[model samples]
Target: MISVEEALRIILEESKALEGEEKNILSCLNKVLAEDIYSRDNLPPFDKSAMDGYAIKSEDTDLYKDGVSIELEIVDLIKAGESSDKELKNGQAMKIMTGAPVPEGANAVIQIEKVEVREDTLHISEKVKNGCNVIKLGEEIKVGDIALRKGTLIRPTEIGVLASLGYSKIKVPRNPVVSILTTGDELVEINETPKFGQIRNSNEYSLKALIQNLGLEALSFGIVEDKKDTLKSKVKEALEKSDIVITSGGASVGDFDFVEQVLNEINADIKFQSVAIKPGKPISFAVIDKKLFFSLPGNPLSAITTFEEFVKPACEKMLGKNMESDNTFPVILAEDFKEKEGRSKYIYVKIKAENGKLYAYKAGSQSSNQLITMSKANGIIIMPEGIGYKKAGEVLSGKFIFK
Candidate 1:
């Protein structure tokens, strides 16, 4: 067994980002940029009016001081998407609508509401400063400037930016296809009644939902029997069809556990067979033919725990997302808990906020098979290795779940 950090490092070091593909900008939302995006044309393209206003030289209104009004001749009216050829001289103004290009030699625009116009003469009581109410050419983004760097996440705001930059199609990393397979002879489908000493398979459902939460679809190969040859064939097929394969069950050491044997037989590079983490120690990670394979424990809580805390990061990295930052925060324990000293313990609990401090309370029994314990939890408190038994009022690092 290895430390959780070492196991994670091995997984990430073995994972590789997918190749880039040309996707339509609209469909590229939530995707990672493959190249630096430089502006092909200046935003706005020219000096335009920020609002409905009159464009005039700033010095033209210098004489209007002490609540005095100044009058200027109106040269022409420029509406949106229109331009004025008239040169704005001192004592002359052009009525420009929002988004209308300002005429040459104009340095200021006074809002229409702040000025009165009568008989083609514009009157302004307040002195308009230079560059007032005017959006200069390339104010948002200049030509040749990088608008977005490579590896940036594309959001709705990025969609608008790309559209403005005339990027109808963009290059983004290809999303990896994930496959799910559940194993065990004692497991039955949710719709079927389990025989004596059998239970319904819930790990497949949990894994599928987890994959969907990451905006990726998973193909389920249904349930495979515990036989070594059958499990081996299904694992091979999953590897052939998908970039990532996740199998929940037949991972732990037991009379019927055959995940390791099958992996060795297939010549797969098994990175780690176990990690020093409670409820998920039997999880295994392997790389075969440039594809990732994860054998998660059969227990429902253990399977979910391993997937969320370990497999999710590998998937995210392949999709060109950063996952280096730790989400743990100091949380006070509201109840006492005890465990063995060999592995790091992750206890699911209800976190409550009182007086701006977070406190972790027991949700239920922390059993590997008890999915109810995980269901009732909003967060998890992590107890580090070496030390055991934490009493109420003790503090541990914790983070919200499924956040």
Candidate 2:
């Protein structure tokens, strides 16, 4: 068995980012950019009005003081998405709406609320500074400047920027296709009623949903029986069709465990057969033909924990993205916890905020098969290896898992 850190390092070191493909910007949400994107034109394209006001020369309002009012002739009216060719003369003002282009010779804008308009003339009561309420050309983004660096994850704001840059399509790293296979003779389809000794196949469906939530394509191969030949055939098919293959169950050294045997038969390079973590200790990792493989434990909590800790980071690495931190922070234990030492333990916890302080208590039973306990947990309290007992009020590092 190896430490969790070592296992992750091995997985990332062996994985490489997928190739890039040109995709429509609309379809590139969550995708990583393959090249640095530069602004083709200045943001705003031209000097623009930042508010609905009158564009006038700063000199016009320079001499105005308290109880003094200045009036100027209205030369033109400009609304957003429109431009005016008329230039502002001395003692002249243009009625400009927000986002409208600033007319030539206009150095500042006085908001309509600060002025009293009567017919074709405007009465300004407030002194305006030069260049106030004006957005200069290229103020936000300059032409030929790097608007977004390579490896940036496309979000809604990024989409807006790409549209402004006239980019209909962008080059981004391809999302890896993940194939899921659940192996066990005791597992039955979700739609069917299990016999006295069988259970519904929830692992495959849960794993599939988790994969999709991570923005990766998931291909479900359904449940493969415990038979070695059947598992081997299904595993072979998944390997050919996916960049990452994940099989839940048949990872431990049980009589029905056939996943390890199949991997060995295919001459796969098994990186680690176990990790020094409770509930997910039997997890296995391997690589075959440059494709990643993960054999998660049969238990639901164990499977989910291993996937979040190991597979999630591997996927991020394959997409040329920095791994997101778990956002772990210290929390006061609400109750005492006692366990034998040997492996790192992750206990499901429900967190409560009291007087601006966070307190963590066990959700319920810590059994790996207790799905309800996992559901009630918003975070996980981590107890490092060799530490056994934790009394109430003790500070421990906890990570929000439901985020």
Candidate 3:
């Protein structure tokens, strides 16, 4: 078996960049931007008033002392969205509202509440400072500046910025369509109660949820019986209609493990046979024509882990989105853990806070066939190769399922 890192490198080397599509501004939220967005024009576009006040020159006010009154002429009254027609001169002040353009030669703006206005003559009691309450042109953003870069995933704030820049449509990468096929003769649908020696088909539903969490769409093809002809037909049909094809249960080395055989029969070039990882050693990858195919283990926990660690990054990177995992953290073990000295082991454990100390305890049995243990686990404590039993207070890097 090849190391997990080597297998991943081989898989990503075959990743082809996804093409982009035109989307309406409303629908482009959270989609990766395919082109850089530059500002159409200067923000504010002109020198404007930042507050509702009287625009005047520094020499217009002589009432520096408190309660002292100086009579000045109100030459013009400007409201928001209106441009000033007259320039400010000595002994003249303009009543300007917030967002109104300040006239040329205007030095300061004294608030209306600070002055008493009788007809066109305004009495200013407080002295005004020079260049107060003014927003310079292009202060927020300049014209022709790159407001948003290409390959940026649009968020709520990015949408607001695009709208402010007068962008009603955006170019973004089309989301990849994942076709899920769960294979097993002993599996039954969720609606039907399982008969003796049969289990409910959980991989399909779980895989659908996992795809949704990555912001991708999943088209489920339900449970497939363990037969060569049926599996080939289904896999071929799914690959034809989907960008990525995923199948479970038929990947492992067993009498019924026919996924790899079917994929090879359909001419899917095998990229990697197996990875050195615990509970997911049967993971496989191949490419049919130009589409991607992932053969995950039959176990639910193994399927989810392999998908997150491998398949998700490939999909995200192809879509031009960030694919780095920021969930890895150092955790203190709550109990001793033993594993083989060569291959890395992912131990499912539940973490808790005890008197301000973070400790991780093994949830249940470590058997790969046991789903109850995986279900009860909150995180996976990573046990690297060459390490023996891990005792309490031993710090090991772990992946957190949730923050």
Residue-by-residue lDDT tens digits, candidate 2, 173-292: 888889999988899999999999999999987788788778787999998888999999999999999999999999988888998899999999999999999879999899999999
Q: Kindly report which residue pairs in candidate 1 clash with one another.
A: none
104 in model 1: Cα distance from truth in Å? Answer: 2.3
Q: Candidate 3 lDDT (Cα, whole model)? A: 0.83
Better of 2 and 3 by TM-score: 2
- lDDT agreement with native, every candidate: 0.91, 0.90, 0.83
Per-prediction TM-score, please? Answer: 0.93, 0.93, 0.85
All candidates: CA RMSD (Å): 2.1, 2.0, 3.6
How many Å off is the CA of 319 in candidate 2? 2.7
Which residue pairs clash in candidate 3? none
Clash number for each model: 0, 0, 0
Top-TM-score candidate index: 2
Residue-level error in angstroms, candidate 3, position 149? 1.0
